[model samples]
Target: MNSNFDDFVKQNVELLDQHIDELFDSDSTLNTDLKMMMKYSIDAGGKRVRPLVLLAILKAFGKTPNYDILTVAAALEAVHTYSLIHDDLPAMDNDDLRRGRPTSHKKFGEAEAILAGDALLTVAFQWISSTNLKDRIKSELVLSLASDAGASGMIAGQLLDIQGNQRHYSLAELKHLHHLKTGKMLLFPAEAALIMKPSKLQVAELVKDFMANFGLAFQIHDDIIDVTESTAILGKTAGKDVDLNKNTYVNLLGLSGAKEELNQVLQKCEQDLTSLGELQPEMDLMILEGFLTYLK
Candidate 1:
């Protein structure tokens, strides 16, 4: 399943590589400079995890996938990439490298990087709005994306994170921070899939549970990786959290305890999947394993 996911991402990368320029060209209203900046960040490579998650959820529902699916997937990815670009700016995580290349700010100057992130974020919504999907699905997708990516979600989480950097947080506070910063966006893919098929309420609830737990687990694993992984392996600088004195799961709970929490979250996600009873147990297991493997 991991191999299949990787292969799928590779294929999607090729498709994105082909269509990215065309996507910009199709919209003449987009300012040329902003379009170029947006494209610059969008073209910068990453794992394409958010889009892959959307595609996986669609596949899990037995939907007949099409180019429209890829378009929406790409939009979600654009939003995520925009966040990364902004997050790496001097005002945020202050990173110099991303995906093993100079960050947007480092490569394009701070002003361009800021504008690029803004353009990518706005273009994400533009792509969604212009998609030929049903009005209801498009509305739901836009709403879900906005809710997760907006101030009350990722932005809120980010604020707490910056604040938490200078202070220690209890487990509850840490969870709140992560739920906003990371978990909400993770939940968006599953929720967006539900929007694509509104009748699947049971499946949607199951997916929501699965995504919530999985998202938390993913964040916990990220904290672990930040402590253990090197820049070469992580494709970005490690130990930044430590340098910033950020409060992380590892810092609060200790490495062993943090790993145990991750396992528990994974276990909960598996339990939710089992309760769903519609999905293949093997597939669920594969996803769980893939999540762990990718984090490691």
Candidate 2:
């Protein structure tokens, strides 16, 4: 990644931290345990990629940053955090660590962890609905998010994951599951940002294609990490997929093949970005590439 991207990432991350702190800091007065649990879940320090990507998309269109933008982006992060909380449950992946800290269930117990996820999910919609953005813009984003997070999207992907454990899926099947699970969330930000700047509609098609490829590439990189990195490096239970005998890019395509596939996706995303032909093309590419710095 370039220094420019590093700076961009730093500024956005700092702003995102403030937004999160202010938003959740108010909830601390509600119920001490639930508030602390909320803080624990959000404050555990993940990448904050979902919100960052939303802002990046908006910046690419030269849209001025606003509190409303941050508010909506925070909504997406809440949904993502909720997903992680539930994913670590005993009934799910049963993970014990996340971002190098104890998983929510381990730290807060299953009942509280479950409520925390519910709270986070509801908070996401509340943020969006209460935002002062135009009603049409707000509704579009909420509807897009609903499809991505609900039964037809990530939830369905989770169902496939649980059922496919210890089972092999063809390449096509794997991509289908991932498109639902990870790809839709990535696309949601792009779609929502375009609504804020309808003039970018001409470029929206290319952005969609870029996000789809990038999302799959991101997951493949994750699979590679599980196989190659340590638990300490991953900040989560590494190689758990192998221990669980789960299907993954590495299992289906050898390590070398997975890397090759990742390269293809990156190349495709680059092509889509270049086709955008706008002032922010370089920034757009940098934003995408910076996320994959682990590959370097």
Candidate 3:
């Protein structure tokens, strides 16, 4: 990533932390234990990647970060964090660590962690609703987020992922599982930004295409990382997928093949981003393009 893109990411991460603190951490009305659990996971370190994606899309379309935009981004982070909390539950991946600390369940107990996840997920829409954006825009964002994070999207992908433990998946099946599981959330940022700022039909199509490929690349990178990185580096158990016999790109296509596929997907992402930049010549797409390099 270029210095400008790195700077943009740093600025947004700081802004997101402040916004999330205002929205959740500083709130005093909630029950003490539940609030503590939620805040613990929220404060748990993460790069705020989903929120950054939303902010990057906003910037790509020439929209400056505002109260409404930051709130929306924070809401997106809330949902992402909620997913992680739930994913670490005993019934799910049963992870004991996240973001270099104890997982929510381990730190707060299973029941509290579940409620915390639920609270964060529900409150995310509340955050969106409270935004100063127009009612229609708010509605669109809520609807998009709900669909993307709910049973039809991420949850469905998760179900398939668990089921993968029992069965072998072809490469196409694996891609489909992740497209719903991981792709939808990644795609949501671009979709939400376009909703906020209506672009030309051509530009909208290109943005969606760019995010679609970007999402795939991200998932492949994650699968590769799980095998190659350590628990300390990943902040989660390494090779857990292989241990659980979960289907992944590495298992199906081998490490080299998965890397090749990631490169191909990233190349497609670059092409889509290139077309989008040309279509909207006034916008600097460097930040959006910078995301691809991270996967590589």
Candidate 4:
């Protein structure tokens, strides 16, 4: 699954790269500074996970891939990158590195970094709105993206994390935080795809369960990576979460306990996928394999 996922990711990266360049070229009056900053942040390179998830979901549904799909996928990635930019600000995570490069705030000034993040966030909507998709699909995509990234979702989780400094939380409280901070964003790709498909309630519910469990497992794996991997391997400052006094699965649950939780969540996700009769076996395998790869 890891090898196949990596290959899929590589292909999607190439597609997104072409589309992004085209997007820039098509807009001549785009503010040069903002464009540069946005491009830098987007191109700075991560796993491109959100867009890949979007594409995978669309493929799983056997939908005909179109320009609208790519546009929405890219927009999702834009929103994600914007969040990282703001999250690394001195006022937030106060990080100096991301993806092995200087963080936005480190390379550009704090003010520019803030503006860059703002631009990316707003432009994400612009990208979706300008798409040739149906108005209904466009509206749904916008609403999902806004809700997931807004105060009630990722931002709220971030606030909780900031306030959790030097404070320990119960497992339930920690799971709530993870759901808000990490899980919501992760769930959006799958949810957004379902929105595009307009599936039955049962199928929608299955996708929701699968994504929710996958998101939790992913965050747990991230916690493990923070403690087990080096900066060189992680492509960012290692052990920063511990330095920030942030609560993590690793701190709340022992390593063994966290791994146990991850396994349990993965099993639940797999079970949910199995319940969706129309879902392809390859897609199920892909999602399951992808989750397993994250554990590495």
**Clashes (candidate 1):** 0
Report how far off residue 258 is in candidate 2 (Å): 0.6
Give the top-scoring candidate (lDDT): 3
Model 2, span 44-95: residue lDDT tens: 8888887887887778777756888888888888899899999999999999
TM-score for each candidate, following the candidate numbering: 0.91, 0.94, 0.97, 0.94
lDDT of 4 by residue, 171-256 (tens): 99999998999988989988898988877787778878878887898899999889889998998899987776679998888788
* lDDT value for model 4: 0.83
Report the lDDT tens digits of candidate 1 across residue range 1-296.
46965665677667765666678888888888777777777777777667777766766666635767777877888888888999999988899988888898998899989888888888788888888999988988899899999998998998998888677999999999999999988899888878886645666688888888878988999899988999987878998777777899998898999999988888887688677654544333344335445654
Per-residue lDDT value at 218 in model 2: 83
What TM-score should be assigned to candidate 1? Answer: 0.91
In Å, residue 41's CA in model 1 sits off its true spot by 2.1
- Distance from true position, residue 65, model 2, in Å? 2.5
For model 2, what is the alpha-carbon lDDT of residue 251?
A: 89
Off by over 4 Å in 4: 1-3, 277-288
Task: Give candidate 2 regions above 4 Å deviation.
Answer: 27-29, 278-285, 292-296
Please identify which of the two predictions, 1 or 4, would achieve the higher lDDT against the true structure: 4
